[model samples]
Target: MSAPTEVPHKGLITASLMLATIMQVLDTTIANVALPAMRADLGASSDTINWVLTSYIVAAAIATPLTGWFSERYGRKEVFIASIIGFVAASMLCGIAWSLETMVLFRLAQGVFGAAIVPLSQTFLLDINPREKHGQAMAIWGAGIMVGPIIGPTLGGYLTDTINWRWVFYINVPLGAVALLGCAAYLPHMARRIRRFDFIGFAALAIGVGALQLMLDRGGEVDWFNAAEIWIELGIALSGFWVFVIWILGTEHPFLEPGMFKDRNFVTGLVFIFVIGIILLSSLALLPPMLSGIFQYPIITTGVVMAPRGMGTMITMIAAGKLLRVVDARKLVVTGLLLTAWSLYIMTGFGPQMDSTLIVVSGFVQGLGLGLVFVPLSTVAFATLDPQYRGDATALFSLVRNIGSSIGISIVTLLLTRNTQINHTELVANISLLDPEFAARMSGQLGGLMQSLTLTRGEGAFWSVINQSVNAQAAMISYVDDFKAMMWVTLCAIPLALFLRKPTARPAD
Candidate 1:
């Protein structure tokens, strides 16, 4: 007798997938704001507590490539269901962890499970949704990816402040339970030809992603190449990544197919997703620190300001879904890119005492642009894909976007650091003048400060005044320089959107 076919209920399956995707993405940043509380409770130092985050990241990164294979062998329903169950169990363990080590381990387990949620869910949605409506299906799914992190930190911040950090993980319990049950009841499991697991590819991918994440997160603190651990991890990451990239291409039975890359529309969609990931992740990484360090907004306030970005995303995605039927896919994507560019351009003008309304507007605009891009790009990738390859394509799309974001975060962090130094150097040079007019101006301010402080008029007073002025100027210029650099990067990404294979209009009935 033939095995029972898994025929997923469309509404139930889609909801389950969406819920799980949101949970996975939210967990990535939801724990971020609660790190302080977690540090104290786990009796761990700041450095040690970082593992809670890193472990999850490494697990997800390593598990990403296996999605295609897992879905192929086990049936998409089984793979997805098992993954969410594992994730829920892990989240529970995380909440109950008595030590930092245990929490880190749990987080790692969560990552392993969480990694499958997005790609598998996408595959499930495609399986259930009608071909003609695939674009709209992607529209809803794409919003989770784009808006998850935006809402995560805010949710985390509120939960941690009002309740305990453990509630954050515990909250996922009920949600995951519902998702798992929903999947079991409604997910349509298609028959799959099982293949032996690619242990070699898996190991290489795991090591590469783990080492690379470590390097990105800790490189700055350890002074980059100067530290032994940093260098060792860097070596492992590069060699592993290079080997995997080469092996995947050279081998016939590699985890991902080389032909997947051959699809012009898919590849083009990937390009947009990759760049969007970079822009979004890098901006998220950079923005909060600036707010706290320069603007001194509390954690909750920071979350409040970031809320507009998510709101914009939700609003734009809903609108984009309706508009999809009217507009060609290519035009939708281009419009998204242009809007994102404009949003970044506005951010370049931020300064001390900038209006609060303007900052929120800028964030909202950024979200709107991202919403438009993410949905269209996601749908574009699958427009011509066969059902057999949907799992592989979805996984490939996710992995590439993540790689882009990682590279983006690393590059932007390095850029900001580099630009800060340059600005600092130039600012100092301008202040150290020997000109008569400059000296006179300096002397006037110097005397006023000295008189107020009741300091003696001499070399000491002049030096003190100059030093204070230079420090203030350097700080102001550093922020200005960083914004300008980000603006240029986003603007430069604009023309590259043209390179993507434009989506075509469907024929009339």
Candidate 2:
């Protein structure tokens, strides 16, 4: 059957696409908390269990660039339907996985299929809706995108705790089934064109992305750059990326069209999305461990505290949707960067002794700021670009965002660990028996408390406790430093906001 020129059953199609989008995005983080349980049951070591996450990330990163080409080769509906089926089947296989190897393989398959869902969903939403409603549509779509990551850990923890770790994978079955049916019923067909596949370009891009993802994922584990594997991966990543760029520059039908980059707004949008991605997922990566490990909060409690952040995002995203029509998009982005930076600045002041209110409030504010930035950014980014380029552009947009997040998380986590060690050494160096500060502190409340516990100053137990306390304090200070660093990063984006041009209103919308 030929594709309809106009969107049919728009509501059903929108809901279906949203479900598919949420299902795919949710998998990115939902399996993290469940990893330990999977490891224990499968008799896998710590090193091997991580492959479950790495496999998916690398596979998805490698496959995502292919989405635009695939959509052009096959119809959108066909690719989306096949993707849903493949993803659902893969999810089932993951749930039934009896070994670590099987689990990793299934996860890879899931990643490959799941990668298309996001770009396709974005393209579909934009295609079906009128130009004027694009902002509202994107706000809805962005909500699913943003909320999925926010709630992933909480949902995964609940599923793993209440039932079993397998349920996290299994939960996708019903949801995917509904989405599949909806797509089959409501999604329209698109005209397919036969374009010559750029194997060389694709290969180079895939190798680069795959190697980069591996380097990032394994860097923290293997001590980065020190390990031969990391160096090799880094070399491969750099070489492959440049090779692809060079090939695209010279080739007539390169994988990525040069025309897309010609648009100043799209180019600026790329930089903005990259920064947003870093801010979005990196903060998320830091918070859970800080809450659970440092603050001694339970998983559920951590989730509860983080929930308000998502609520703030949802509220502002809806508002930003309406604001886009009236306000200069550049202003919204500036306001967002400042708000996000302010939130991170507040987080830098956090101490282990503080209550959860600070976290909740700051998180909500940051979310509001991010929500404000994301909607307008998406709206203006695509406003001047040709509609034919939407699929490829969205794929690249998602790719850049994902890469930024991966890099951001890796850098922050490494810094946190390294800074903690540095801080630990500095703090420990001062606590010598000859130091007067140590002596006076030992004579104060800390000393009095230790004395009441019947622990003598020079005893092994007393020294051990002192060392432990120093280490804990050092780690807290390191976390604060990381937050401060992120704040600066957010603030740095403010000036770039000036580069973004306001989107001119269209009569068609």
The lDDT for every candidate, in the order shown, is 0.78, 0.89
The window of 10 residues in a row where model 2 has the poorest summed lDDT is 500-509
Model 1 lowest lDDT segment of ten: 1-10
Q: Candidate 1's residue-wise lDDT over 345-398, tens digit each?
A: 777777755656767888888888777877777877777655566777888788
The alpha-carbon deviation from the true structure for residue 401 of candidate 2, after best TM-score superposition, in angstroms, is: 0.4
Please give the lDDT score at residue 252 for candidate 1.
60
Off by over 4 Å in 2: 1-6, 451-464, 505-509
Query: For every model in order, what is the number of clashing pairs?
Result: 4, 0
Q: CA shift at 410, candidate 2, in angstroms?
A: 0.6
TM-score of each: 0.87, 0.95
Q: List model 2 lDDT by residue over 1-509, tens digit each.
A: 22234677988998999999999999999999998999999899998899999999999999999999999998888999999999999999999999998999999999999999998998888888776677888898889988899899999999999999999999999999999999999887777877889999999999999999999999999999889999999999999999999999999898988889988888999998998888666999999988988888877998999999999899989998888877788888888888889899889889878899899999999999888888888877888777777778999998998999999999999999999999999998998758998788888876777765555444566667778788778889988999899998888778888888876653232
- Report the lDDT of model 2 for residue 199: 96
Where is model 1 more than 4 Å wrong at Cα?
A: 1-9, 249-252, 421-476, 502-509
